[model samples]
Target: MSETKFKDIANQITSRIEQGIYAAGAKLPPHRELANELGTTPATVSKAYKLLAELGRVESFVGRGTFVRDKSALNQVIQPQHQELDFNFSILQPCLVLNLNALTEAYTQAAETLSPTLLAYADDSGHSAHRAAGAIWLQKHGLQSASSENVLLTNGAQHALSLLVETLTEPGDTIAVEALTYPGILAIANLAGREVVGVNLDDDGLCPKHLRKVIKQHSPKLVICIPSHQNPTGITMSVSRRQAIADVIKASSTYLVEDDIYAFLNNTPIPAISDLLPQQSIYITSLSKAVSPAMRCGYIKAPDALLPVLAAHIRANIWLASPINFAAATGLIEQGTAFELASAQLREAEYRQTVAADILKDFYETASGFHIWLKLPEHWRVDRLVEEAKKRAILVSHGGYFSVGDTPNCVRLSLMSISSRDRFEEGLIQFAELLASKPMPFSDFLN
Candidate 1:
């Protein structure tokens, strides 16, 4: 039978199904009958039926004939399963286990104290008291000069990023980012129709020399960076590197967007780029990772000059950050629960990092954040490792997801997503074992 003939037959049947001529749950004509009707061989008709089955337009049964499947039902069956230890992406699930007693109490107190204000539209930037709390929260992370007037509340860091991109840049504006940085920023830039240039990095984080080169070449209006415990790579900038980058920004026309989300996870305090060059920086952080993502609370400290524009963007985009979320976050910060939870999460992360270090045996360095960047062996393929881990029921993210230009031969393992410490250790050991093994040959699969 000709391949073209079978494909034609399949296409015709698919068209009929889509047109509703073949109602869902209605059985398809028998292969022999359809072949006889169309003046084709039964084998060709069987091939067409197989194609339809693969496309999920029809299902075959042993005794029962092929029947049209409900499109929505097929979609449900094809959807990916939600697994607990699936670490293809990283998130702070340790917050799930955190005691919410304080948060509950704070919420109740906020309800009474914030009273009629909580029931109405809040200030576009934030209520003065909430912004005051945000300022204090920033100070806890070592940004000593944060003031309530300059702070603007956001739904989360991701929301703040979108707002900043829209407010600070125009379409087609170039933005400089680390060579391998947070994927979220890349996604936001792509959506906003802006360009992102990658800067090189070394052990100390963003290489100032490469940054200078990129700034000179692209003349980007903004440079986005995660200087503290950067995502995927887990490299924290040394004070010298921070100063160098700050100096570069101060000299250039570029403004800096510092994603300080992971700064709270640092065991020791590190100075933010905003500290060195406040006028040239827009600093963003959130309680989503350190406290609870449910609060949807994020804070931005831009130079006073940008406040009105940022506020305008906030009003235009989301009206205002949820007043309830702001109230909860403020209560937590003023009541000190935010600090307490952050300290506890930091300790938990350190313990998991130790576990990863032991299990991986120097293959990677685990930071005081949720993830570790695992360097692959010279011959090991990152894609194959990710696939093999999936086959073993362990999910992990490959370096390609975070790469701005070329994908690296590494994988990122998230330590805190698995709630069970023992299971997380087992997963890491399994990953190490997979790394030590050789890939199976194509001929082996054939045999």
Candidate 2:
């Protein structure tokens, strides 16, 4: 076949994809079949498919034929409806609308002050000023041991967790985590080939007794805990509970990764558990939740002994997080804009929580955080409730995503995700109505 003919075939396929004639994730016809249909040689069809693969329009498996790539995985998860109807309660982010003005000003100033030093590649860890600003950010969130020398920069909290998992433990190693935790943590552990043993969680964040048992039984090389306003569960560690958990880790000599990303949500500062075992703990926090996720600034406060390895890993992985973003972050932190934004987000979260409590008063007990861990009615299963909510354009996180072992009959509703107060309240009321109604018995369909 002529080169022009093959190019035509690729363009034809692209048009089909765009027109939805070839659906997302649907496999294309066999090359020979498609060639016959298109009145072209098999070689021409193969070339067209190859071009599509190169352009990231489709993916080919060795055994399975070429299939159109899903446009965006996030769209499937977020399930966006029309603007007036969409109530996306699945995202765990601050009310982003609250920070746009500050972010605009900050980014404008960042563009104006782009020094060659700021634009250039940074030291493996980061620029000292950026690191010092990171220290200040962590210090505000309760990591008093933070300093330029001990703190390192990461793309975000997710990147920090990935880097730590990659650096500290080998593929076959074990790590203990909260029984119910963030899905991101589970993703990191699973992808890295690390065995995750779930320690029981009580009224407090992580149960020390169960943690000691998990340490004894699984012999995890590291223990990860979310100390403040933990994900999915909304539990914060009490000071005594923090010390007790620290004592257990101190006794076991197992390193603790304190993922206090939600620390700023606390009205009163809670002293970090990392402070109890400064040498053995790695505290992670970031501006993504409060200031602006687009900036992608995250901080890690590691022990002096661990700095070199962490810095080496950061260099090996990303060379260094873009100094440009850190430059912007430094301005925010040094000038106190970051803390002020965090405070604003806290107030927003509080208001949203109150709204949630008012709507879900009878069903849910606890409040105050970015999201709620709502236990469902005995008549409603979590999967069914989630399906029902999505049917009404109300997106919520299934509790199963956050559980390590047996999945729970609960859902996590992110209050701050839907910025419109009216829409958020409406969604909550709809969700409450759904909860009040029970699914019909399976026998009813048969009848």
Candidate 3:
């Protein structure tokens, strides 16, 4: 590696050390160890270590190892300033407005209604009543013809996704995802040993032209997208954009997986892409986003052709979704409490969105969902703002978390879970103060 690159790597290591992940007086890993982990050579690693030792950021004692030194006095000599900040804004937690009474009541009712035979192994698909209730529940959202045969309940969205990925593609196959997609999808792709290629997105969400290009280049086995209220960015794909993406999927023989976890609370409901190409699409929507995160219930809708394969995957992995959780969801659907709770959540989300807009009006963009995407001012970088906010006991998410094609000059603020309006404002004030202050150099904590 070039000297400049070597120093860059050294600086990164020093940053980690300062964060206390690599503690002072601890021996740095062997040259070969670091080299293998970073996919670099021992020579490059050794040179970086040598530079670090010469600068006294690390001390190499004879025969022992390199140790992080006390660099408080070395502030004048490239002592990177540390910024402490809180990170409450970027997370999509479902804590603030959850109605636990409704959830518990549903679970209790399901337990009471469970058949004596339910104690035995559940049907590989799900309970017949539960599936029927699930179909009825989805019908309210505009998806039709979903009978017990079409719905399969799973442990949760993540488990359902794992089964979908395992059943749909081979180990080395690739899938197309949004440039800035959910980390859960990323984790699943990594677990399946499948490649996840990124497609560019616009205000309407995923760009059809870019998706078409990626499909041709990678010929992915599946095209996965979260069309409604996307994670992180919280932007919904418009009807026209949704249809355009559907057209692209229908044109190709490839399958589509539409993650509609965020569909429940969206006031302006877009037609499920599954409706556009039911034969070639599989829809996974879960209650984890609305009713209760503790209520681990998710449903899958697939064409008749793929049901058996998906069922087999579920059977092999987890015999079936728990009868208890399925019963709870079914009871809630039957009693209409789940829908009520979902409506309340929508009201809460809109209120929070409005408050966030009111605070960041000048900086807000035309985006829907629960998060506010704020473009950082030219004078301020996201990392600095994050750290300053932390020191003031407020937190926000950096743009790096939701970036793919190009690094955006922005950050996302999740306003749903935070309870205190005053605290939220105080944090935002700290953030604004940091933005208005003379900027400091970036540090590890900001990320």
TM-score of 3: 0.78
Poorest 10 consecutive residues by lDDT, candidate 1: 72-81
Ranked by TM-score, top first: 2, 1, 3
Per-candidate local distance difference test: 0.79, 0.83, 0.73
List RMSD in Å for every model shown. 9.7, 11.3, 8.4
lDDT tens readout by residue for model 1, 295-348 = 889999999899999999899888888888788888888878889988988888
| Global Cα lDDT for candidate 3 | 0.73
TM-score on alpha carbons, each prediction: 0.79, 0.82, 0.78
Which pairs of residues have clashing backbones in candidate 2? none
Stretches > 4 Å off in candidate 2: 1-84, 440-447
TM-score, model 1 to reference: 0.79
Per-residue error (Å), model 1, residue 364: 2.5
Segments in model 1 whose C-alpha atoms lie over 4 Å from true places: 1-81, 85-89, 92-95, 99-101, 111-114, 442-447
Residue 362, candidate 3: how far off, in angstroms?
A: 4.0
Q: Please tell me which model should have the higher lDDT, number 1 or number 2.
A: 2
